[model samples]
Target: MSVRIAVIADDFTGGLFVASNLEKLGIPVFYVCDTAVLHEAADGEVLVIATRLRFMPPARAVAALDGLTTMLDEIGVEHIFYKYCSTFDSTDEGNIGPCGDLLIGKYGQRRLVFGPGYPDLHTYVHEGYMFYKDRLISESIKRSDPITPMNDPDMARVLQRQTAETVGLLPHRVLHRGVEFARGYVDDQQGKGVRYFLMDCVDNDDVATGATIFRHDHITTGADALAIELISQWTSEDAGTRRRTPSPVARAEGGEVVLVGSCSGVTLRQRDHFAQDNPMLDIDICEADEDILMARALAWADEKLGAGQPIGFSVAGDVASVADAQAKFGIMGAARKAEAILAGIAKGLGGRGVRKFVVSGGETSGAIVEALGIQSMQVLPFDELGAGSCISRDARRISLFLKPGKIGAEDVFSAALEKMRAP
Candidate 1:
């Protein structure tokens, strides 16, 4: 049987790289992030879920991530691969460096992966302008900006070395990839099983088209189709078995539900998706003013309480930024409002009733818990990186954290709610 797999991230390059290396290992895998796409791709087999972290603001990108966390927790994923957002700047991924220790300590039966991820699109373009003004590609990243990887050679070296370390630590090389070319130098290269790879639509296509086609705008839509094709090569034998169809309607009632919409420009649309099963309100706490979110949370609680309905909230949103290094610095901005909601629910409980909040979405999970002073709340645990610290109480509700990049299937979110319910 092929090695089943799933990959999550804001971008696509990382997935291709992972798949390329894994293909050599003779392991089959599937790379996915979108809900519709992932559901279409799953097979009933032991699976690995690889998720990438970006350095953008949490508010812009946490919703989808939370959705993924919920799905992974409910359905269960075997290996946890975390590729921290890469940076050309020195302080790209601060405390996140120790993610391996974090996941393994908390969640049982899982592996650890940490990527000194590549720079986001803007960071690459802007910094590239400074690095290679001689070629003159895009004007957006003007020469005024300092060059990265070029000017800061030390940062590049650190990232290169760490990228290798990230892939080298995996249990078996059967289904692993090295973003940095040199990481997958394994001894058992002439091994047994078939190593396949996962890929999103765009990146997969680009890799398929290789040097034969290189246009100016062509790279924009470049996808790594070979990754998907490789997966197809392996999954074709037993795709029917690994595939799963989630329940159409939520298994439980959506009461006192908390709504977190952090995705940009598409807040109401995303809210509608959630509202399909539950009475969801579009509350993008990340972009909305902190005070506004607090007021909204209070109001949401009050409305639910008046109806004698226990509130259970689901957090979702996008938190993308131009330069990840600059935006994630003071992450407290995203944490405060989420903290308020958790605290409000806690206070409303009066230490008695069934006070439970189903926290979904990556940014919502991380920030909300942090706001209530809960440090390392648990989400979809991979290993040490998954095990976070206590949510230090600032007189707030109990907080929970979820991993990034996933689909919020009905069953998965339902499971999280079940975990939060009073035992």
Candidate 2:
């Protein structure tokens, strides 16, 4: 049967992250990172596509959604979930708002629910305000994000700046009223021309309530928080039949590499933590020519892999200089060059018998997969790092640990390495 659920995510890591959540609940899920393989047939119940549009312009994001929705419709997907970061990562002139509006218009779904509160991830919503752990998102370090800084904690105000549609709220109080009451609240909001509702969810139960109430065909938007409940509701009755055993972990040949490109404070800490146990090399792309940088990176990778030692390749400098790179090579051009270099490094390492990789940073992972010619990958929950292990679709079946810089523990790299080394 055709997939009933299809998720359009804003980045590579987030797509696999959501798929891993559903997969663990016994839902067969196919995570497609490259759009070219969107039509690849699968026996799975869900298909998650990584659009990597969060970093793009608003118009581009909308256009991408248009194409993705059309493809999903052709593939007979009955339900749509537009997944973004649990932190509600986006700019005032958003990729989230515009893309969400496009999906609403395409599906003729009167109301779309927006909740980025994944309590497990410490993201919560209170009175329509977004919280990171215990602090309001605006009060967090994300306020100084290099690309799309989140300055507002109010979900309504945050989305209002991106679209002309009326933004409404599914208050925490209404959620506690149970399914029917919550469903009525949604209808009431729709009557007031609120096309988008930011639903408040403080815990798993609240999210389950929202999921139980919404129709399967209704278009929902959020991180994987709501997905946990939705998948459970869909398969609860047939749990025994739908469930599958966990796949066996495979032994990794050759050495591994953890590539760091993001400049988030969390990534900085992770880099320092991982470096304490592994050899870490810094690539100074800004100071050298592209050719020289590539050559040096390859030489370093060769030395590490040749010695059977796990190593890390980190880009030197912070994200504050992103504007400088953009000024030098235009916004999109800068992104392209960065991806190109990272992809080159991956290709060089992979050619030299490196079978496993830990690619951090959303854009970096996306680019690395594409450069390595991975059209599609089977996603498995990697660890408590909130990342995913991916096996390429090709015969090589290369193994990868894709982590979005901000996610994962201080010893995430160590955990990933151990898993990869596990037989």
Candidate 3:
């Protein structure tokens, strides 16, 4: 199969989310951690490269994409899609707009389309304002996020703060006119020198319609839902050749454990809701001493594992304590320490015969997968929260469910566990 789309995801979980969606549509996909492995797996119909540039500075994110375009060009991949979190997670000094700018510069395109709203996940953008399940992002729990606190709900305004070019809106009204009209409208916008567009999508159809208008060379942006739409269009040309076929479900044999390091309200609810029936361990970053915290957590986990109980680990504390830790150690410092602890616990538990894993937060999941020596994973279907199983590509072959943290429901953890254990 020829490579139809080359995706550059901002983080690991985001890459898996896109890859899972593509796989569901029967579009063969190969996901790589970095550019070095691109040569090892070049035969898949779609290539999703997971880059760690999302949390970096704009200059760094742009710099990271420097040699990437040349590689993509040589590979004969014409269409490039830049995927970020559906929640639009980034600071005013964005890795989104800056990274988008770099792609535009490399492709020499006068216009680019960008939107993070995934209606299936209750993320929507209308009239240039972002809404998380109808609540404006500024009024949502994301406002309290320690990393990229979404203070302004206006996406164009938010993106304008990051890019030098003017950000325009491609409202739902344009999409309602149909894909051809939308394509014409986009062309008109490009003629006006509008380089960046914040498109509105209320549902999958809206995204599909918007995606239908995209030329093979036009750069598009959004979450996995957008990619689903894009892939659907590309595959429809040969419907008989690329239809979904059922396969036997793979059931993992082991108890499950969940580790959460993301402080998003969505993850907080998932962790707390799943905690109702599961054993819980909370890591207090304010404990100040890493050795003592690690020792205590390992002891507690060993005890739970010995009894064969499903356990949970969370790195969240009370508001005041978290603030104090951030104030003392700085945000990056605190995050690194928390990830280290979680990675250590993951390695320890995996060594003790634990195979089933549910990891929340991108950084936390990345650290655990790396520590567990998981180079790649086979995506498995789960519930609508976009949670899916990833069997480790290595000989160890552990099962994992990597949640996007900002997506999923309060019962997402339990749902994922149920999926993992399903016969």
For candidate 1, lDDT tens digit of each residue in 333-352?
A: 44444445544543443333
lDDT of 3 by residue, 249-292 (tens): 45557657899988776788888998898898998877757777
Native-referenced Cα lDDT, model 1: 0.34
TM-score to true structure, per model: 0.34, 0.93, 0.91
**Residues 93-139 of candidate 2: C-alpha lDDT, one tens digit per residue:** 67888887788887787777787888988889889888887999999
Per-model root-mean-square deviation over C-alphas: 14.6, 2.3, 2.6
Residue 219 in model 1: lDDT: 9
Clashes of each: 73, 0, 0
Best by TM-score: 2
Q: What is the lDDT for 294 in model 1? A: 54
Best-to-worst TM-score order = 2, 3, 1
User: What TM-score would you give candidate 3 relative to the actual structure?
Assistant: 0.91
Model 2 whole-model lDDT (C-alpha atoms): 0.78
Higher-lDDT candidate among 1 and 3?
3
* Per-candidate local distance difference test: 0.34, 0.78, 0.77
